[model samples]
Target: MKRIESSKAGGSQFIPGYVQATDYSDLESFMVAKLKVTGQLDMQIDSDFQNVDGAVSNAVVPELWTGIRDDVRGVYIGEFAFWYSDYISFIAESPNGQFTSDEEREIIEILSSFRTEN
Candidate 1:
């Protein structure tokens, strides 16, 4: 489990999460599973951009996905996944759910910070 936390509030504010990288097949199909997941609501894919992950097997075209999880138990989830060649890197968080606005901003910051360390 991984979390982003801030201690500036006199206490830690955090989002519980999980992340992993592995092999997989299909991008849209992978997302479709999350969308159809029982607790997922308001889910959709943003095709705003496409990029590469040079650290992978050659000719491995990467596809990214951002997802929302819906569970009526007041659980809101934010997820990110990248698929390329036969591998996948994924992240899911907000175990207690998220405020859409707050989640969006934080997600942007996280995405923006993604880079390859030489």
Candidate 2:
């Protein structure tokens, strides 16, 4: 993992980590399957950087995705921000397929398994 900072903000810093996968889409797909969406995700996920939607569409609070511009719809989940596509649409929102206690535990385990190989 690497830490990056903004030179303009008098040294505001952020830690960034990327989880690379050969089947990268698999993780996104897992997230979608694990998510419990009560309604539509309000954006598209499968595309690249050009076409994306913001958190407001999903009713997510701004604080949740820091550094996200109003014009930016893609949201960062941990070190990764997801798009509004089928593979990337996942949220912790209640009643929107709230993760069960066991599921939450599983997710924690999954995230915990991550390590910076470099």
Which residue pairs in model 1 clash with each other? 39-70, 39-71, 40-70, 41-70, 76-97
* Best by the TM-score measure: 1
The top-ranked prediction according to lDDT is 2
lDDT of 2: 0.29
The RMSD of every model to the true structure, in order and in angstroms, is 16.2, 13.9
Model 1 — TM-score against the truth?
Answer: 0.27
Local accuracy of candidate 2 as per-residue lDDT tens digits, 23-86: 3333221211121112222345522233322111122211223333323223334323443232
Instruction: Please count the clashing residue pairs in each candidate, in the order shown.
Output: 5, 11
TM-score of 2: 0.26
